[model samples]
Target: MRIIINTGKGGVGKSTISALTSINISKRLKTLLISSDLAHSLSDLFAIKLTANPTRICENLYALEINPIIESAKAWQNLNSYLRELVKNNSLNDIQVEELLLFPGLEDVFSLLKILEIYKEGKYEVLVVDCGPSAETISLLSTGEKLNNLADTLVPLVKRFNSLLGGFIEKKTEVKKPKDIVFDEFVGLAKKLYELEKILMNPEITSVRFVTKASKVISNETFRASTLMNMYGFLTDCVYINMLYPEEIKNSSYDNLYLEERENVDRIEEFYPDKRVFKIYMKANEVIGLKELESLNEEIFSKIYLEEFFTACRTFDIKSEGASKIIEIDFKFASDKEVDVRRIGNDLELSYLNFKRRFKLPDTLSSRKISSYSIEDEKLKIVMDYD
Candidate 1:
């Protein structure tokens, strides 16, 4: 199955692009379009209602708005019920048991897990995802790999400890199984997760299409999103530069906002010379409902260059060196001044002017003490020292 992820600056017509693309693709292939953003308007765009399940919209199209609470209840209800029962029966603190259910990003993680469920059913040709804004979307995808590894290591230890504790605490009682089934379930979950990861990392089967507006706030954000996704092995296929001002206003000489917006388009193209970028003229009316969305799709292809698929020719590497790990990030544009850097616990944060990003240490490097850092060859070098 093919997976297409659309993410860009908010208010850049992302929902329009997602709706239009999914509808167009569905005419020729079976497609499942999913929106993970909290402010989802897929229902509004299609002029039909949507829920957590894959609701059939037309002949070949299905839509879903991922509801994490609903998904968690469906996927983990058995496990959670067992845990809650065990804790309550054992007289554990009520607050502690309740708090255990409140893990951060459980919803985001569970949303991704649902993809595996659909893929396992073996029913669709393409999976189109309208993910959250850049930060949360990338984080949502990367969390699975880290979690899969964590489950692998922790499940065994947890099973052993549960068995030892249960045996020692109640010698007269019948020996209870260590809930080893949970660990087995985790293994199954991890296997499915790993398959999804493999699919995303493969450029041939997966691609990211960015929908961006030509204004400043979103223009800069699109640039950063492009670099960040490329750094993480998600291949960006093409940039859909949406909402361009029409040149008809030039005769009236009312304002230069249109001219300024035109220049932003040129600037974005210059930043990524190696990739294909497509543009769309600003609509006369607001884009809403199925009719306008269909018009938006019709306007796309005539201006689009089919040969210019998204391409990535740069690499960012983070390597371990003794106690510290060195990160080397290369960007197409040069920094005019010293780039800003800050270390917060195990995460290294970097910023240049208004652009900022944070990265955590790899498992192999997080435990080491960072001795020193430097920038050379357009790469950040970090030396690690043993305590």
Candidate 2:
């Protein structure tokens, strides 16, 4: 099983949750924990020096922090060199060429590649990933499909153009044509991304745990993040709200603070009614080292079955009713009053409270008109008629 811990904002105890979860899993099963964040803190959290290579932390636990510079040198030097040459040949300055050669999501791509490599090894029973901040994590998860699409559409066109213009361009600018190795590199990347996509989309093998704090800013970002994850077909099993004040401090000097936290907690529950929400109170001492992390893990997830905690909710499905097709959305734990639906081009946007989920309509449904829509049995059924 692979678990990814993610959050929209930083300093929300995401790394803490990931470490404790890994420790808990390692207690009973062999587990590998990976930090995909560029600004890594897993080593600090564990109080042990770590590197890009996996280091055995204990009997059944292993950990690694992805160093993008090292990983890029290992897996992306050829690709980067090709891009640099291409840019330099275009009459661009050295600074401009260098900037272009440093691809935006190369690190994220390498991170997924690393995960795929470890997962395929089949040496560990559980894999826990401490993902980067929300935007980068989303980009990393979406990179595979984007790269595959580019390979299918842009790569062949570029290759053909390069072949046709090689001699002419070389004579004009004294630039060398790109070798076959560059195209081979592109093909290799595409294949790896395709494999990673399959593993990420498989709910039985992977699940995402979203972490946030009980505040307006974090709560709002959490909703948007969860909606986007669902859009990409990633299953979010739970939402962890950390650093909550304990009830004992309710009427103390922190009464107002507790009230605000309570309100935010309620708001989160209302927003993500279907997800399991776990609140971890602020610890008396800083949570560090294996012993403290293990205790924290027990406090948060002692009776919880990590493997069986969440079954991915089937969000939508297509069905046949007589000669027409119907699109059914499962809005379990939600009500008609809570949902507002609208259509934008070929996409349907469903909003509940402050959370919005958008679904792209298939060609069959996009060409047809909505005949009727009804909410029944915790489902929003939209009947589509043949155009």
Candidate 3:
């Protein structure tokens, strides 16, 4: 399924763009548009009230304003309640316990869990996700890997440490130490976490699209979005340059606005030279309600004949040349930046400017077994074991 996640610096008109994109796409395909941000404006963008559950906004379009606060309670209620008990029993202040309930990872984790459920439903051809800002969005995608790896290594060690501590205390006080309820809760959480990661990294089922402005400050968000997308194998298909001023503007009063748009798009094009860059003209009024959204779509996508709602490049083809396997990585969305390649022990490390990722080698592979590496046809091909 095509998963478009629009995010960047706040007040970039993400909600409006997200709604219009979904509306335009739903015309041709079954689409599910979801808002993952706390300040929900999908309802406002559509000019129709909505609920947390999936609600039909149009013929083939579904919109959901996911209330993470509510979802967090539902998914983690059992665990959170258990945690609260421990905190209260230890004489921790109630306010502190409540604050602890709203942990850093719970919101992101619950949001991901929501996405997984929609993906499993297997109903929509495209899932348009209006995600949180850069940091939260990146955390949502990569947290699965990080959390899984952490739980795998730390849980057992933590359990063992708790056991040792419990035994020592029990012997000194001549009283049985209470069961490690916290550890058991963690183990339970770890299992659920593993499942979440599996679903997120399923390449066949998910992809990410970023909405960005053509400004210098916002460009940093693009760099980070690119770096994170690569780490999680998320194909960032399209980067929408929103609220661009027209080239025909002659008003000196608004010249700076037009100039900035030009420079922003130029900068973005330099960064993502090969990938398609779409520029949406600045509209007069806020894009709310179906009528305004339709007009906005016309103004923005007029050059594209209003055809497909999304733009992307999907190229993941592993070919065998004689005795070697060549895995090609697409860098179409990446500029002509210098790519750094090194062998850090058993992992192959590749980094370019703000982007980097490590690929672990299997037992059959050799460091020198890599026959060659080159960028051709907008793809980076790594040949393994070719004589």
How well does each candidate superpose onto the true structure, as a TM-score?
0.74, 0.82, 0.76
lDDT of each: 0.71, 0.77, 0.70
Ranking by lDDT: 2, 1, 3
Query: Which residue pairs show backbone clashes in model 1?
Result: 237-310, 324-384
Q: After superposition, how far is residue 173 of candidate 3 from its true place, in Å?
A: 10
Model 1 ranges off by over 4 Å: 86-102, 165-178, 251-254, 302-309, 312-330, 333-387
Whole-model lDDT for model 2 versus the true structure?
0.77
lDDT of 2 by residue, 240-289 (tens): 89999989988899999999999999999887777788888888899888
Which structure is stronger by lDDT: 1 or 3?
1
Q: Per-residue lDDT of 269-330 in model 3, one digit per residue for the tens?
A: 77776466677777666667887887777766644522233434444446777778776666
Best candidate (score: TM-score): 2
- Candidate 2, run of 10 with poorest lDDT: 351-360
| Clashing pairs in model 3, backbone N/Cα/C closer than 3 A | 214-264
